[model samples]
Target: MENVCLSEELIKSQVLCAPETKVVIHGEDCSVYKIENETGEGVITRYPVFPGIEILYNDIHMTNGVSHNEAPRPNVVEINHCRVGRFECEFSRGGSIYLGEGDLAVNVMTNITNQTWFPLSHYHGITIAVDIPVAESILKQLSEVMGKGLDFDLSAIRDRLCAKNSCFVMRATDSIQHIFSELYRVPQDLKDGYFKIKVIELFLFLNSPELVNKREERQYFSRKQIDKIKEIRQYLIDNVAQHITLNELSQQFNFPLTSMKLCFKEVYGSTINGYMQAYRVQMAAKFLRETTDCVTEIALKVGYQNSSKFAELFKQFMGQPPSEYRKSFVQ
Candidate 1:
């Protein structure tokens, strides 16, 4: 398929095509735009919550295939957090980064072209977009209100972003997660006002001296390394029943132990064992729902020898014991 460059106009004409999708305008520049797949199981909605701030919620599954899209937005900054499945992004210059669950990617678009892809055809997350000058003004007003110095240099951040080709991906801190969690729970009627407050909170957290300094020190990986790590991930998925260790994978793939550990975590946002355990549980859940197998049989199929251990892990991942989880469907 040919790669398409997405503009504001394209989002309306090409992307939001499902019959149930709708756009509501509140005022001149404030609007709520919603899009969904034909089944309504996947949806993406954007709310222009403030004059220069926009919040987008995504709960979408790309059942068709992978989508390769390019976005060219000038003088805008985007904060993308992956709360569920991971997504892969490629910069205009062949740079790539992956955002996994609880990971945040902050990027500034100033004459920059960035492309995004859904590796697993599923994503659920929130995106925050802010116009540069507007965000700067908001920060100043907030500083005055709180009586804290809140010394922030937006220009400096912009310079750094430009230096790095307008992208930085990091693990989401607890403070960041808390603010977003509160925003997610805010009542629908009060969303506009609450969004404003929460966005200010996000700015304060990002502007802290510690975070600002951390941004300067970032890891850069070669494209070759990223591709190799992705291959290793697929290998793990294919052999979920086998007990794969780091030493074994390193020797087989010819990757240094340290590089594999670091890159794997960056790409998948979890330790090797954690990622495998989560993936294994997901496979087990599929068996529980689709097949008539007993709990012990299902556990052994997904690599667990002890049925009791499998039940415990399944509860941790799926929030219910296997029997109860299956019963909910039957009842």
Candidate 2:
């Protein structure tokens, strides 16, 4: 595994303009690092609102298999929001969390080197990392304002948030989406103040009574199980035009059918069929944009023998008919 702290070095090596990828401090507590490569660009901007509280934004274009990244930090609490694409994170322990759009994952660190991979060619998101002690103080102050007592121990909360191997996934509710969307729309001039405010707002939302019970922990899988599931996923993608059955996958991977289904869902946040359908549609869309192939031929290439059915599915997934979708870009 690569050192998480200096994964930036990995990027530097691939970046066309290495010197442009550098860090710049905005104020006493905020820093921003800009990264650019041949395929795309990225910026990691961070605001240290408190002694140990940080709010960061990651806007990047990521191509598949470009690279994987890991960061090793101890006792770090991170809240990740996937605004655009999916994030597949492999924890040091044994499991992985697949965070999709409007999904949230809270990760508590313990000197673990967690690796993050982008499933698509692009990713854009924001993350807030808080230190336990720092959050304790903030929680205390917020409690006093509400005239409420601190019934739960901060450490306990920390442990629970990261319970079951250090990561939990939650759905981003409407309120949560609104908060982050507003943050994204903030004017450049007001970004500094907005960043601090949003970080506090996020904590408040997390602590709200409505959200506590709604929090759903991500399911955990052993390293071996997860690896096999990943293999299955890749195999499906590689042979997108073909139909593969659960029994076949299970027998091939030596995994129980039920376990394979559950584990695949846990890692990809979708059933195997659902994931395959999505992948096929994505591949079809790529063909529409990059190739001059007609809709019927492209449909067959992606495993769809019926052109009309292919167009219907493509419209459902891509929001327009194949011809229009292609014309929008090509014309």
Candidate 3:
């Protein structure tokens, strides 16, 4: 049987065909897929860079998770780079892993599960999917024509990074950041050509033995643990006006203190204190813009008793005092 390209397979999947999804084709080679759920919506734009190789930009802002039902194909490899926010991937084999800002993950399609979502309710990332056999042949032909040794093997890279059917994650490095940053900033007119060059450059970078050898070993949390951690997150968000200690959370949620700290950070990409601090400021900003509440009232609403301290933290996070922030939103 002829190989079906990864992009084609994804387009044929029910997830993309569901009532909540809207697909808009820009041209023969480019398309945008939008998804809406009760919580929020997500947009994915895809460009076919080369035969059997495609690039997708995923911009998701939804609290509710999306279920995937695409059958796994071992011949396909997916490369994901998390530009911002957190991606919670649940594997069919068991357990879940997270991709935070600047992180890179490479895995076979077979390892993906039916459930995948963004932990922080938002994620912006890039995905490069390669149909190994077809891509390899195309790359080889291009190399011969260009007279440059683009002899990197996609399958070998997959094997090296994803041994044992496990996803390989690499923490953000300077080189990785540089490559992706350029991709993110490419001019609209230059996108097509720029993407082709960058995608080739990306594969070459991945082919490095030194890089793969030093890949980070990320921790995976069980479903039950992830549920409890999410519960703890919701409880904290629901009661942002109150101060809660880690010890109290551990006892209240029946989760160990050490694991709670570690897993929470892993899943949400921030410590509990850090996450709450940011959340409070975000809520305060919302109130400042949407409500007539005074600074002190707004501060108290977000659990700050001292208006001065609230102003200080607000400036620290938002680059200006709350009063100024609110005024800027005014006429």
Question: Which candidate number maximizes lDDT?
Answer: 3
User: Which whole-number lDDT from 0 to 100 does residue 21 have in model 2?
Assistant: 55
Largest TM-score belongs to which candidate?
A: 3
Please give, for residues 1-331, the per-residue lDDT of candidate 3 as tens digits. 1333456674443222233467776555688888888888888888878777888888889866677666777888878898999888777678777788999988787776557778888988888878888789989988888876688888888888888888888888898898898988889899889998999999999999787687887666788988899999999999999988999999999999999999999889899999999999999999999999999999999999999999999999999999999999998
lDDT of 2 by residue, 6-76 (tens): 23332232211133556665444455676655556667776555555666777767532233234544455
C-alpha lDDT score of every prediction, in listed order? 0.67, 0.69, 0.83
C-alpha-based local distance difference test score of model 1? 0.67
- Considering summed lDDT, which 10 consecutive residues are worst modelled in model 1? 1-10
Which 10 residues in a row give candidate 3 its minimum summed lDDT?
Answer: 10-19
lDDT of 1 by residue, 171-274 (tens): 66786688777866778888878888787777667665556455434466776887788789889988887778899999999999999988887666678888
Regions more than 4 Å wrong, model 1: 1-42, 62-74, 111-114, 118-121, 133-157, 160-166, 216-218, 244-248, 306-312, 315-329
Error of 2 at 56 (Å): 1.0
Ranking by lDDT: 3, 2, 1
Better of 2 and 3 by lDDT: 3
Q: Count backbone overlaps in model 2.
A: 3
Runs of candidate 2 with Cα error greater than 4 angstroms are 1-30, 34-42, 60-75, 132-165, 208-212
